[model samples]
Target chain A: MSTRTVDLVDYDDAVRRYDPVLGIEVHVELGTVTKMFCGAEVEFGGEPNTQVTPVSLGLPGALPVVNRTAVESAIKIGLALNCSIAESCRFARKNYFYPDNPKNFQTSQYDEPIAFDGYLDVELEDGTVFRVEIERAHMEEDAGKNTHVGGAGGRISGAEYSLVDYNRAGIPLVEIVTRPIEGVGERAPEIARAYVKTLRDIFRALDVSEARMERGNVRADVNLSLRATPESPLGTRTETKNVNSFRSVERAVRYEVSRQAALLDAGDAVVQETRHWHEDRGVTSSGRVKSDAEDYRYFPEPDLVPVAPARSWVESLRAAQPELPVERRRRLQGEWGYADAEMRDVVNADAIDIIEATVAAGSSPAGARKWWMGELARRAKSAEVELAELPVTPGQVAQLQGLVDSGRINDKLARQALEGVLAGEGDPEQVVVARGLEVVSDDGPLLEAIDAALAAQPDIAEKIRSGNLGPVGAIIGAVMKATRGQADAGRVRELVIERTSA
Target chain B: MSTISRDEVARVAALARIDLRPDELDRLAGELDVIVDSVAQVSAVATPDVPATSHPLPMTNVYREDVPVPALPVADVLAAAPDAQDGRFAVPQILGEE
Candidate 1:
């Protein structure tokens, strides 16, 4: 999180010497019920072998059936990103060696991704909107998860043995790539984070993948290079792999920018290779280099028939596109009457959907925002759960606020009831009833408690009688305490005033 | 099209992790040449205007609900693992500690 002042003298010389350009390829696992080309369940963290089918396991006689739902999800994502859908596409083999890939080769779309030539409008916090041009978004299968144990550093070296889970294998993935981005300059890191955040929102809006960074559902591979200025030929770029979160993406990019800049300043030519972003250390280490164009031995997948989606089908998909994240943010800002900062906070917290649902459940927009952005958000953080997953319902929230509005319960009591409801005690009203938390609106019991307090504290009562109305609050507090906060303090205060005065 | 040498075919097979016998490499080289030659028909028909297609079906704007669901059970996932321990898949030692 530290930034160094660029040695302008060195940078000036380097600028005359070199320029940096960047590109990013992001892979998002679609939240499909099944695998891309098989019926095996598309899930993460499963009992390793249970989800695999013959096709996903790459059985000798197995044939990929092409999950229709996964294809549709890919198309939706493509259109949401403002990409053009190709009328016809075919699957090709991407051959590679890795034990995690059961097939030893992946079935992917090479030249014919589902969508291409799109752009994503990413807005930084400073209101600078960068149009990241999309090169393509292609559909492919994910490899299994590998656990390299007993390695010297838990990497591929000195490993005694390795294990892999195929639960992630064959899961549908849409890799959205961006062309080398220029003019990002110093804003490179911010732009990187914002772009991925915006993409997460779009995925949520389009109902594609869950886009959970922690679970590796959506991952970013940041390609970074450093140059003196915008006008020079691009320098060699490094690819950082599997950055799972926006923060890491930004950090990785910024680190690479500095590292590469420093390297270039030292007159060292930047190496074109893959790097690993160690999130813990906030530095990138070397991975394998692509010395040559890897010949994947790609060819048409003979097992499955070629997909020939009709023009009408593509049109229908386009028509069915959901409101993209940018549009949704703008609309929600206007509809909720929230300031730009507040809306941005909601988006950053990933609570826009929850707030929207709460509003839809009859809560005032401002009220919904307040609760979600405040107590609910706090509770979600404490429990490590999403805001929407909290047990309290929107109707209950509105009903609790309604109780406060009608003076039937104080704010503190309402909060207590909320906790009760969140604990599965029931709705707001039910929690209030079950806990005997309703205010003593009748005032009879409150007056009796106030009298008892007065008898116990004669000097304080005399002070109240001597026109010290502030002391009346003492009696009100006593009465409320006696009645376990069920007595309305305001009404008790009024009774205490009248009695003390008389 | 360049003719694939037997040595080249063997190297590719090694990279792909498929063990091929010396005799098999030549046969594979011939077969690969034939396949590559046949598939090169794409180049003949492909014009600058003819876009290479990667997906068989034309699709755009497909989506699914973005809700996070439970990951598959660790036990279930590990059941398929060739090796596992302590609820995690175990693998061979990889890198020397820095």
Candidate 2:
């Protein structure tokens, strides 16, 4: 759209001589029962003040007590990532001043984190598995939430005042950082999204946290840059932050790539800064530039005791690792015989567990897949809810499938019954019974209806008698409509032929 | 350990906003200096073999459930607000004369 596109050859030449390097820092909130260093409840959306304790609120004379469960969870996360757990780790104070953090300084680990030098194997949508190297995974406490009012769109600028909710304060968070990933070039964004998705899968499998992006359980800070050649020093990078979804992450990276490439092609050097991704606009705007680490003065946290996890403790956590996401996905694909598209749909929807449960509840594999991927998915979309949160149980879904399998209900009627179940009317069988929507497979009633329709339309009856069975569908459709969708079409067709021959 | 002065202790406390008593500040400064100097031993022993552990477990890409579950009811969330108006948290006036 600019002059940069006009000089195609020059741009190609620049790209041929350049490479882009990427690094990412992701923060995931663990699903521990208590705060990171206190006994306050680790929950979202409670009565704001009810979740707070003295330690979480940073009350004077209140000392911090580390939650052993949080430490164990962090250790489990580290071990699952194949990191080396430190025998001894000390919490450091990262000093800052903001309304959200009541303590003024965040207690975190510096210079020595809890885990280091790990790697995650992430597979892209195209089936390319890339190993994203992990730099470190450190544990820290979450700050409280801030709501700025009277601003230009409730942001920092023009804000009249800010309010703080300390419920999230002192919550445990594990931040995982990635080393500089090279050679991705154009596929950098996809790789970033895949990496986050893979991480989310791992968390779910481990029962660590409900990594709902909307709830801010998992968030990513994507760093991107452009260079002149693979051997050249990497160009300056811009970090786009708080990208909460895979699609948004991928889009943010691609946007940055084109934006940076255009700037470089126009002879402008890219600025290294933190950028904010506007999901509504699909654009990035500059926020702040961190040129030095001196801004955050790091010191030891004196209020808490130093953590000295025993070697035996680390070993125990490692031994309890759950089945990894990639392996599970592969195994499920083979077991279900789902094509790539079908398998991807399940993975992307995060409906694998629900589908598996339905199958376990006695539904055929294909039938379970169909209902979850089709009707349930559509209902979830229209109602703005997740398939997992649907009111109908897996056993109910299997029962509904049974009705269809035994020719007791057609696909349309099954869908209607499913809707009723989702509306809390009752289970599928109950809905059918209460609404009198059971399939009319009795030949006598079907024959009466067929004879009445034939007597009214003698020409159509003659065509059916002459062996044209296609029009039978029209008659079947009418009969089913008259019966309020309670009649089985196949049995109605069999009765129609018998009446015509007589 | 070298003793810390009252002036230095006051400065750090003001920066950190603890509002400590004069005597307590003096005692804390001394103790902090000793503690910081002692803990600096980590820098000396830390080498390439001593990998820094951030998390104890080998958890690589852990994810949360992607489905958007319902948040706590708005009335419940706002009930804990220090001040509220029209189902939202209210705050004191912050703007000054333009």
Name the candidate that leads on lDDT. Answer: 2
lDDT per residue (tens digit) for residues A60-148 in model 1: 78777677777888888888888988876767788876667778789988877879999998888867788999999988999877777
Maximum-TM-score candidate: 1
Residue A55 in model 1: lDDT? 67
Most accurate candidate by DockQ? 1
Q: Per-residue lDDT for A1-502 in model 2, tens only? A: 0113322223344345557688988888988877776666666787555566666666568677666767777788888788889877778889876666766788898877889999998898878889989988988998887677886777665677767677788888889988899888657777988998888888778888888888999999999998887778888999998899889998888777777887887798888888888899777877766534545678767666567778887887787788898898889889989999999888888789999999899898899999998888998899899998879899999999998898778888898888889889998988878877778878778777877888878888899999988788878877787688888777788888888877
Model 1 chain A lowest lDDT segment of ten: A1-10
Give per-residue lDDT, candidate 2, residue A31. Answer: 88
lDDT of each: 0.78, 0.78
Single-chain TM-score of chain A, each candidate = 0.91, 0.92
Task: Give residue B50's error in model 1 in angstroms.
Answer: 11
Which CAPRI quality tier does the interface of model 1 achieve?
A: incorrect
